[model samples]
Target: MGSTMFIELHAFSAGSHIRGTHIEASLIGLKRHALTNRYKMQTSINCARNSDKSYHEQHKVANLILPYPIEREEFCLCVFTTKHHISQHPQRGDRRSVLNDSQPDKNHKHRHLYFDEATITVSGGQGGDGEAWQTSKTKTVKNFKYKWGTNSQKFIELPAAEPADGGRGGNVYIRVDRACDSLLHIHKRKFWRAKKGYHGSSAPHSTPGRERPRLALTQEDLYISVPAGTVVRRKRSGELIADLTSHGMAILVAEGGAGGIAARPSQQMYSRRQKKEKEVSDVGLEISPRVTTSGEPGEVVTLQLLMRVVADIGIVGLPNAGKSSILKAITRATPDIASYPFTTLMPNLGVIHCERIVSEKLIDIDHETCALPVIADLPGLIKGAHKGRGLGRAFLRHLRRTRAMLIVVDASGQDPVSDYTTIREELRLYNPEYILRPHILALNKIDFEWAALRVQEIKAEVQSLEESAVGPAPIAVLPVSAVSGSGMDILISELMEAMRLCDEELSIVRGSAMDSRDKSDSI
Candidate 1:
């Protein structure tokens, strides 16, 4: 009967029939099969249900369904067994694949941005304390007594000794190191202090009185490392402390205090007793030594560290003015190059070696000499830069240290003349003395079709401004193509010459000042 029922159920499930007669026959066969294996079927159904629930909880299955008993028990058993096997034996490669899928692409990149300014508090170490001590001696005689009675000698107290000197406080020093690239190190540290000196020890045999040994006299100095081209100034007074332009340069920021002096010796002294005594006596004494003074405290000061790029020539221009392109063409610096504006957020430095041949007529010996000048490609400046516009006064300070400036203008841009004037006015407004520095006007992108006309108009406008005394006279105007390397040689030569002339003029002024000072000193 069971065999017949199983065959009938299989036939019903195999064929797709939704008729009432087929349904009734399948239900009857399912009831007969359950009765034949009542205990086994109940256990299998419970196990399947538990497996399904466990699988859903562990694997997070979105939607799951169990087949009807009459349809096919084998299908339901296979599905649940497969899920259980997977749960027990997960593949190693599957986990790795999942992790890889969750991570971002390896080609993704990031940049580390650094600040140029920071404020920090620095202090020197405090001095050590002084100590004091004293010594004492006692003597007794066992000689014959007088007619009156026997007596004993009293305890004698010795004079107190001077205390040792205290140790000197430590000093704080700021040093410039080339290994540091930015002010990031000092920015993280808000306060710095030096180690204090050790205290002095008291002398032996000294009484516990108002005297003690002076503190140990030694000074400890703290050295702070900073990047080259850092300018340190007082935070409160705004006083300029030092300008560290070269590597290994250092300055004393805070000075340690002097050590305390030892205590003076006591005036009173006790001598041995000469008279003899027949009676015996006991003498006991105690003395307390005290420290004279403690060392003075070191200086505490707040300082501001400002970093500026050290370069001989600074390139200034508007966005997309080909400044970075020219820097790349002239030197080996690799600045970010893109058609978009503000591509360069930080300053890039490059070295330009200018070679010159001296003729015998001009100089006694003819030789080729090279002047290696550092060039800085600064961030682009926009209108109202002085008023804190795009990349505003943050970068303007970099120009202050430059000996010469190169104003790169986009000849292809509309109204190149206006661009030049705007940049000049912004510089003048930011610092009136900046206008006095020698500068070269570089009309870039001369390969453009209308660039020639724009160059001509810019030159005319510059001339008119000079005639009207609107600004200082520029060194010269040179047309150059950063893309094609056109007029680059002329631009370099002019920059070198301008730097040379400025140096000569500076030397002459320094010489005159020294001569006047000597004459006045002699008088």
Candidate 2:
């Protein structure tokens, strides 16, 4: 054999086998080395040429037998092409599979950091004490001088002095913040208190009963930032405080205390009411801390904060039911997905954009006019989920704020009808009103021939309501393949329509509430 150069290829081939002296040219790419590195595997020989096909054509995957002692230019071209492809798509386990190939975490990273409910104690600041004269001092007033001679001047006496009034305390308020998505920050600390008010000082030269100093100042109110859609309520009584839904919306939870009244002079007797003065004891009532009025205590209350994830459409399904896949196919959110149950432990949010088609391309999808809907993919539910089984309470709580529901049933599962029934029952058990909400049924994993064939049967079975059915039927049932991206358009359109109807219903309810409020005000 003539003198030839050999390129020892390593274990770079993925899934495909290399037998005898022939090796498949397909490689998983150079791992942990440069371009000219040798593959630490068995040697390969023999080469097959396909000069007719392009590099990226979907013709056929043949054994890449490298012909040794070949020209340097051709050899460099093949290796470089393989390297470029590997770099561009480093996450692809299989070329035709889903875009992300990384395995999901055993315990999802987001599930641990999530915080939904918190119990907090908030109090307004205490009012500052009214100040009184600390020590007694002798004051000399000019005595009236009359006609001793014509040059004598008349004198005046000073009015009695009063103690200074105190400043008001700070208030506690809860405000909505768009940037904050979790209550974890507030959950860390259970108590929130406002700054105390500044004390007042007496003015000696002022008029009687009006000797408050000008330096006394009240504290600024304290504002706690919470994510939109947070519902505050009295912890003990369960009375609703406020539903902070919009950005910049705020409400006062606790009010500050009133300032203490200053002590009066010995000549003027102290009175409880402002109407008239009652002559009290005048013995040793000079102006001591005991004689003077003290500050009033502020209001204290314990509040329960519940965080509801606000969204337009909610995705519900059984575990490994392709809910995450549907979300990824429609929106840009990349959730951790595996072929196992409980893969998605936390909710994922995404925005659904609507665009118009013009001349075979996307056009004028103005955000202001054609507003997008924010969708959430919630965790899967099992039987008895409403009773706190498998994070059921959290999943149900998060769904309360969604405008519409998208029930995704795995068509490839043992029983798609049973899965849908379980999810619906769980929702109804948690909140009966949830059954009345608009729903869109989605039969996912229809790419398989068997699943596709059973789609109509599953839809028919779900249509015949159970004996305990309490609400309207689903708007529509669609067969979709989240992995292959088929039938997603119709499913999305149905969901958008359902969301629109829900929004209209909400607007009608709001309008009626406003009208009733106006009538009461007029009356």
Candidate 3:
């Protein structure tokens, strides 16, 4: 419900003694001054009036309930009520706020906001203006009074304005929020502006001659929250500014302007009785007292935000290749799966714990949560994917930060080897760096007799091709049926091992690069 108003007053105040008779004023302004501000609206109020004096025959106080609209009469009495869905303060939640309550699922209502790229404008707040004092030779104060004999008192005039300095403006920053899994929250918003600074003010008990020392209140800074792995870039120049990869990482996007100062008066005195060297020159810099500095403008920037999902392993395959099914079987991800292509438009992420080999068997380690393999089920790719066919470019970028790839192929397809080659070629054309990452082959749909018959042939061909490859070779080839869960245990172990090796290689590369940079800096 919208805001409702409340009003309570006496009808005697509405019209004071008209023809020496009191008339009830229904929603009209009170004639008598409200000493306690009781006339102020609580929420909002609606009043109905009966101008005729016939309704004023009863001179008794009554409690009025609104909404019936049955002609309310008397001194104005107003009250308001609101629904729970309506927030009292939108900027912050109150005790009655339902924002913290469990939300109802409206299937894919905000799916459009899950885009990978977005353009936005961000700005920082302007700084406050500095304070100043009036010029005077001596302290301006009231003189004491003598009470005895002929009592006399002297009073000094005080300025009308308050003596205080303006507060500083807030700065804008980009912070990574772990709860934000996507750019959905900020994608729809086109412009972001921080609050401006306060105007100039003076200190308390300050006079034209002297200013009291005091601490100024600082302003709060503004922070725009985005998901981890969001890359902030300048829209016009395409310059990379910040890359927030991990949670709790943040960067300053714009700096607030510095506050300005007001003109303070200074005295100039010269004496001829002093020596020539002691004589002071009257020529000096001077600022006019009428000058009052205003706040500086905030920084405004148009930015392009690109988000790449950071996962340990990425699943790549053609449309209708059972990638989602394989991911579902491995972890607890319930992705949209169908025989048709492009079923999984947005990427889906699932986590699987790392295991250690004990007694020649896989054992889950409870404390290995830090480096658990996070599997990403990306949207399927098609022919000419690198040429922007089937939204492949957007899907391919999700693999940029992954440690390894899990390529799933439909074993029932006419040519499993050709499909595997097509996927590899697409990755190579999109980015050669992707080929350098470890890759695993999972021949899906092996439960069918016809597909199972050709699984060994496909596996052998893929291994032979991998042996001929340069750096990015297929780590292992395994035939598994997502529907029947055949060979899933061994397939999972191989994928885990491949992910571990890939992570170690990446860490070594990063460490070597850091060492080289250090050496250069020392030189």
Candidate 4:
């Protein structure tokens, strides 16, 4: 093989001094080689260029060489440039020019994607003013001396003016609609004001100013659509104003001011002698009556809106414990599924509809379907969730509004009892009263071989733990297979019964309050 020579070149700056130093070294090496070698020697030149020191200080660029060799056998030359420092080349000094040449500009703008809470001010319209007017008759004598036997009496007409009444103010309202999934639409807005009523007229010959029209009733009220589980409250007091749990729910947050009272004609009657005396004392001009009144202003209020997910039942469990699988099996919700932890990052909701069948032997009755109950699939919880571990506190709040809960546990895991205990302890630590809510324990993945024995052990452990408790009754445990669809019907039936019982209890309490009110009124 012919002898090959390797050369490495490094350039610190593009100044002439640096270039001259490298050139002198190359010349000396060539002179030394010419004295020893008799065969024709091929020469190769390599150049490396770098930017100024100020540009290099900001970004450090490593030396890079082209992979392909320059021409073979013949005199060859190669040039390499620092990729990172190329943007700051002296020839292209404009910073904007570098950006334009780097990449294609995409017209992109940020959008308000989601908003869950907001504080806003709402003011009702101001009322219009009222006006009124009156007419009077006066008699005047032109000459003091009598013409013949009787003095001549002349009648003059006088008119009095009053201000007109103002119009009624408009009210502010908040209506809930199902179309809005987030509060993003209201995020940009900070204040809402209703239209003010027209002012009353003031004229000497005009009739009582026409009553200002009711603007709030005639025109549309401010409608604010929000998700189904929005709660409105007074910002200052934090008092609950309305809970919008259904579609088309509406509430009047601020009432409009009443229109000012209309100006009425003065009813004081003056006798002929009294009028003559008053006319003589005060010039011939009549005094104008002030009967007009101003309209009242509408109410101003600051309110805060908070959104929470509404559901009849909340499904919670550890990661990969088959909570999402259960929700998918029961309802049409499709949550991402994989054999990994933290697969679910947000909550998913589904609705369940079922009919209540009546037995023919007991009585002849039509099948009555119950209201569809919503189910929320929440993110998995870990130990120390109450202390904000693994986003536990966020997931726990989703259960606060749920009427009931369904706890899912992995029966095929290493220790089913420990997993169940960990979840229970976390919930109790977050909120002591949450444990009192009606709940069902669902041991999932019974299809696995190891699940059968573990289920029995978990049931025994739960029974022992319940016996040592002093609170509500023990929660029912049911073995289920989300994959095989086994024991699903029983689970649904039990959940329906629990919700029905809760509804009955609420109705009884409401009835008692109404009865007490009636008795007090009678007394």
Q: What is the C-alpha lDDT of each candidate?
A: 0.64, 0.67, 0.65, 0.61
Clashing pairs in 2: 10-39, 25-64, 47-65
lDDT per residue for candidate 1 within 1-523, as digits (tens), equals 1112123222112212211112234434344555653233553221122234554344323221112323334321111111111110112111111111222211112121345777888888877655533321222334344334435334334543444556777899999987776676664345677777555453233444653332364666899999789999999999999999999899999877655444434332110001111111233322222334566687899999999988889999999999999999877888898898889877888886333213212222222443567899988999888887888988888898898899999999888878888888888889877778889999999988799667777887776786233367789999899999888878877877787878888999999999999999999
Q: How big is the RMSD of model 4?
A: 22.9
> TM-score for model 2?
0.63
| Candidate 2: stretches off by over 4 Å | 1-114, 134-164, 201-215, 262-291, 354-370, 464-471, 506-523
Ten residues in sequence with the least summed lDDT for candidate 3: 268-277
Backbone clashes in candidate 4 total 13
Determine which window of 10 residues in candidate 4 has minimal summed lDDT: 104-113
Error of 4 at 468 (Å): 5.2
lDDT of 4: 0.61
lDDT of 4 by residue, 431-469 (tens): 877777888889999998889767778888876776224
User: Which is better, 2 or 3, measured by lDDT?
Assistant: 2
Residue 37 alpha-carbon offset, candidate 4, angstroms: 72
Work out the TM-score per prediction. 0.60, 0.63, 0.66, 0.56
- In Å, residue 475's CA in model 2 sits off its true spot by 1.2
How many clashes would you count in candidate 2? 3
